[model samples]
Structures are given as C-alpha cells and as structure tokens.
Target: MKRVYLLVITLFLLSLNMSAQKVYSVEYANQANVKVFVVDYENQADLKVFKVKYQNQAVKNEGRWFFTDYANQADKKIFFVKYANQADLKIYFVKYANQAGWINQSKLHLMY
Candidate 1:
C-alpha cells in the first residue's frame, strides 16, 4: 500500500538522522554536558571511542567525537577528566577511526 511505503520511507529518514554521530570537547568540565575520561586500557573503559576527521562523518550520539575548535560550534559538548572515577563516561581511544560508533551502546543516550 502507499501508506506502508510512506511509513518505510519515513523510518529510513529517521534512521539516517540518528546515524549522524559527532562530538565536541568543551574547555571547562562545568561547561560540558558529559564529563569523560580516557582509559589507557580498552577493558578499563566503559566505552571505546574513535575520533572522526569530518563532522559529517560522525554519528548522532555514538562515540565518534569531533573536537570543535570553538566551544560554540559543538554539538554534544564534553570535558576530559583526569581520573576515571571522576568521569561520567569512561572511554578508550581506538587506532582505527571509522564509522563513529560506540563499543558499549548503553551509554549512547548520555551524549544526548
């Protein structure tokens, strides 16, 4: 039916929007919505993050953080914490940077 086709198209578009994930770092922790810590080991991290070069290459709320030069230009602003315990989200940096996604998808909503 035409309605079914329209629904499918709408869902596809929504999925496309949700798939755009990009992150920016704020100067101050107080200025950031999410306070994060970079773990030295992958197992120590709550989430594994990959840095994306382009903003458009990022996902909606995945771990693909794009550090904006300016705080005002950021989407989901974040701050780096010295201690893992002090962080709201603990992440590990991966060598391969592609498809800015999350290793642990549970914390995905925290970015939003």
Candidate 2:
C-alpha cells in the first residue's frame, strides 16, 4: 500500500512539471529542440504565444511561456529562425494571455 501511494505521488509531480511551459532561447540552432519563427501576422502563426512574468503562470501547453534564464531550467529550448521555412514552429506574440493558443493542431507535438 505504501509503494502504491509513493508511485502515485511521483507520477503526479512529474505530470505537473511536464505541463509547465518553461522555455529557453538558445543562441545556436543546433542546440535547440525546436526552431521557431516569429510571424508578421497572428493569422499566419501556428501558435499564438503570451510571455508570462512568472513560471507558475505558464502552466500547461496553452501557449503561455515563461522564459527561463538558463537552458537547464527550461522545459523546452528553442532557436529563432530567420525564415518560416526553416522553422519547426511559427508563433505570434499576443497581447493577452487568453489569446494564447495553438492555431494549427498538427504542429502541437513540436512544443512537447
């Protein structure tokens, strides 16, 4: 019974950590898990992103991102690409947190 309880608690904590949208911007494209492109228009984006001030506010994969100072502290490491064709994901910055979400569901796995 004690083992079962410990296992459940461990899984719950891991799920919470995995769901947080903590990101780090890498200087080199080779070091990034995903290459991102900033779109000129929101309609042209795969995801609409909102920058959150706190890491706790950036929960789940709803496009709310907390930029981490170090790559080791981040859930995902990304590199900004010069062109959309070179990107794994295309994003646009939204003014409000509520406006942040995936526009293209097909590209959702790229964030994970």
Candidate 3:
C-alpha cells in the first residue's frame, strides 16, 4: 500500500516538472515589431492594442510598453508559427488585408 502511494506521488511530481518546461525559445525577444494581439481567433480576430510596460528596476534608462485591444483577454496562441513563417511583412500584411473580406462575408476558414 505504501509503495503504491509513493509511486503515485513520484509520478505526480515528474509530470509537474515536465509540464513546466519552456516551449521554443525566442532569440530576438523584442525585435519582432509584430504586435501579438491577445484576442481569441476562434471567436473573433479583433486587433488588440496595448501600451508599453517599463520597470525602473529592469531598465534604468527607458523601456517600451504596449496596450492590446484585447487587454486582459484570452491568449491567441502560446507562440506564433504560421504567421511568423510567412514570407515577410509585406506578404503578411497583404494577407491580413485580404482576410477582412472573408470575415465580412462570413466565410472564416476553420481548420476543422
């Protein structure tokens, strides 16, 4: 009985640590100018605005902050993959511009 209890505890601890592992690391943390709007793409894709955040303790001089349109809202994705993989900003912007028609026409492309 004691062995089974210990096994359960050990397994729980292992799962906890494993789940805490970080996802793909980013090299240029703030270099990417693309504003990751915190909106639920599943329900709506409204661009969220945000203000820049700064902490004197971290940046003694200055810092950048941003406000999202969907501030304090749900996360879009853990990390951007397809959006980042697109050719370049030009292509991405063009695609974004065209998506409005689909949305307006009530033809959202769901990958299901």
Candidate 4:
C-alpha cells in the first residue's frame, strides 16, 4: 500500500513537470504566453530549448519544447522574435531534442 501511494505521488509530480515541457509557437506576440528570441549563440540564450518531434517526447520545464501543429493543442504558447533585443526570453536549440533545459530559471514564470 505504501509503495502504491509513493508511485501515485511520483506520477503526479511527473505530470506537473511534464506539463511545463510542451510549448507552442504562436503567430503573434499578443497570442503568446511569452515572447522568445532565438539567439545566434548558446551563451546568449536564457534557455536552451529542444524542439521535440512529438508531444510525448517533451519533458518538463527543463526546456523541452514540443511545437504543436495547432495552437490550441499547446500548453504554453510563445512568439518568436526577429532579434534578440526584442525578445523577453532568449533560447538556443540543442542537437538532441531531449537535451533542452533552462540555463536561467528566473524567467520561467513567463511561460506559466
């Protein structure tokens, strides 16, 4: 019984964490939960975002972003900036999609 309880609790936490992983890019900044910029260099990014091919492949707020084909399917919607200076959040793409994560957690709230 105790083990079962622990498992349920663990799953709950995992779901919450996973919920933060899915992201959708909105067409306009007004529709986005956050405004993002893709930095030319990794060092200039606030978060290292991994673009997952599938939504199930996305992980928690660690920067795993799953771009939904439709905007309504996304957890947190975001808009990309043309320039780093115009962005509220700056991100860099990693080679492996799962390798995504936030270098700076300070701006995390903007997503939620």
Model 3 lDDT, residue 52, Cα? 26
Q: Summing lDDT over every window of 10 consecutive residues in candidate 1, give the lowest-scoring window.
A: 15-24
Per-residue lDDT of 10-111 in model 4, one digit per residue for the tens? Answer: 999877655556777777889888888988888888899777777787755677777887877888888888987788999999998656777788888766
Question: How many pairs in model 2 have backbone atoms within 3 A of each other, for residues 3 or more apart or on separate chains, i.e. clashes?
Answer: 0
lDDT of 3 by residue, 15-109 (tens): 54431111122234343323232333423432211122322121111111222233232111123334433312111111222232122222111
- lDDT by residue (61-105, candidate 2, tens digit) is 899999999999998999999999999999999999999999999
lDDT of 3 at 14: 71
By TM-score, highest first, what's the ranking? 2, 4, 1, 3
Ordered list by lDDT, greatest first? 2, 4, 1, 3
Alpha-carbon TM-score of each model against the true structure:
0.72, 0.87, 0.22, 0.77
lDDT of each: 0.74, 0.93, 0.27, 0.79
For model 1, residues 47-100, the per-residue Cα lDDT tens digits are 777887887766556566677777666766778989888898888888776533
Candidate with more favorable, higher TM-score: 2 or 4: 2
Better of 2 and 3 by lDDT: 2
Q: After the best TM-score superposition of candidate 2, give how far the Cα of residue 100 lies from its true spot, in angstroms.
A: 0.4
lDDT of 1 at 86: 83
lDDT of 2 at 84: 96
Q: Tally clashes: model 3.
A: 14
